[model samples]
Target: MTGADEALARDALRCGELTILGRIRSASNTTFLCEAAWSDRIVHCVYKPVAGEQPLWDFPDGTLAGREVGSYLVSAALGWNIVPHTIIREGPAGPGMLQLWVDQPGDTDDTEPDGPDLVDICPPGSVPPGYLSVLRAYDYAGNDVTLVHADDPRLRRMAVFDVIVNNADRKGGHILAGVDGRVYGVDHGVSLHVQDKLRTVLWGWAGKPIDDETLESIADLGEQLAGPLAEQLREHITPAEVAALRRRVRTLLAEPVMPGPDRHRPIPWPAF
Candidate 1:
């Protein structure tokens, strides 16, 4: 969607009357698939209520809904549209997060035969030509498999965004290949912690030099965080978390290199 269209959609999500359609059973939290209507516009969205949030030992301060919105704000500031248009509003279950639903390329089977798989597991030594190998392990059937993700620029941008947000749960399923030909990332409820909690399956570009354009975007993001964006983020995360976010941006600017996995658990469980 164009910038204007995205703005309109965000407004719709903010003002629309929400009706819970059904429960997204696959989600760990109590999430609902809902329809939002405002004026003459209608859109599908996901709603996650704070009351249903499962408490985490590490991130015990803010609500997950707020963190999701915070992640969207950072993505919007970067002008990458990596996260879908998202907002916080009262829903059928009280206050919660509402995000525009992105249609994936293969919504039925989660496989796009005519398109590239942004992240996948395949037999050893069968990584796609343009894909990067991440891990080698044995599947449940005792067969050797390799975890890999496509070496696409859009996905690379998302990896950088994950770093800026300190996203702790960027599972393979969280990366969506939208039918609009844009790659989008979802499920940011576990992001923006005060500590370095980055975890993801997209370790393909680890230690590589970030491109010039992305560095420019990160620089712009740092400027935004110092001004209005910082104030906006404070509504969701703590002052310390926002300051840590600024430090992460500045550190990346100084280093200009992607970081490799440094934690004991660098990738999330059930990679897909």
Candidate 2:
């Protein structure tokens, strides 16, 4: 979206009146598709109220919504526009995360071919020409399959972003190809933890040397985290978590290489 459009969307999310349209039943926590209206503008947004957050053993209760907003703040600092315009506000279910909805290609028109999913599963030894293989496995029918993600630079930037945020659930479904020709990641309520909880499906770039331009962006983000960004993150995550984020950035800058999968639970279950 253009800068003005994004500004408007952010304003709507921060101050608009929210009307819940329906529940997203597939979500583990309570999620609603809603309309946020402000002045003469109305935008569709996803609302996940703090009151509806599911208790998790690893994450503290009632903090997931704030983490979502925190993820957006880091994304903005990176200047990558990887996350949608998101904010915290009081909704029908109480204080929660309200994110501007991104329309995926073909979401509103079936005739338009759907955008290519950055991550996918294909038959063994059949990875796409421009894609990179992540893992080899078997499907329910006993057929061999390979997990893969595109080698696109936009997706690579997202992979690096996930590393910086310590994202614990970078599922394939969370990588969105917006109709506006931008890539976006969503469902970041499980990120920004103090420990190394980097679970994801975008392991195609693992072990590769990061490009210089992206490294510059990473360096810029590192500087921000030392300043206002650290304070902004502390509003959502703990002080220790913010400190951990700075450490991750510093480590990446020193190494300048993508990390490989963890020995245990490297990728999330139900990879798609």
- Each candidate structure's TM-score, on Cα atoms with residue i matched to residue i, is 0.96, 0.96
lDDT of candidates 1 onward, in order = 0.92, 0.89
Model 1 scores a C-alpha lDDT of: 0.92
Q: List the residue pairs that clash in candidate 2.
A: none
Report the lDDT tens digits of candidate 1 across residue range 21-138. Answer: 9999999999999988888878789999998999988889899999999999999999999999888889999999999999875676767466447898888888878899999988
Per-residue lDDT of 131-202 in model 2, one digit per residue for the tens?
A: 989999997898899988999988999999999999999999899988898999999999988889999999
TM-score of 1: 0.96
219: Cα error in model 1, Å: 0.6
Q: Measured by TM-score, how close is model 2 to the native structure?
A: 0.96
Q: Looking at model 1, which ten-residue stretch has the lowest summed lDDT? A: 108-117
**How many steric overlaps does candidate 2 have?**
0
Identify the leading candidate in terms of lDDT.
Answer: 1
Best by TM-score: 2
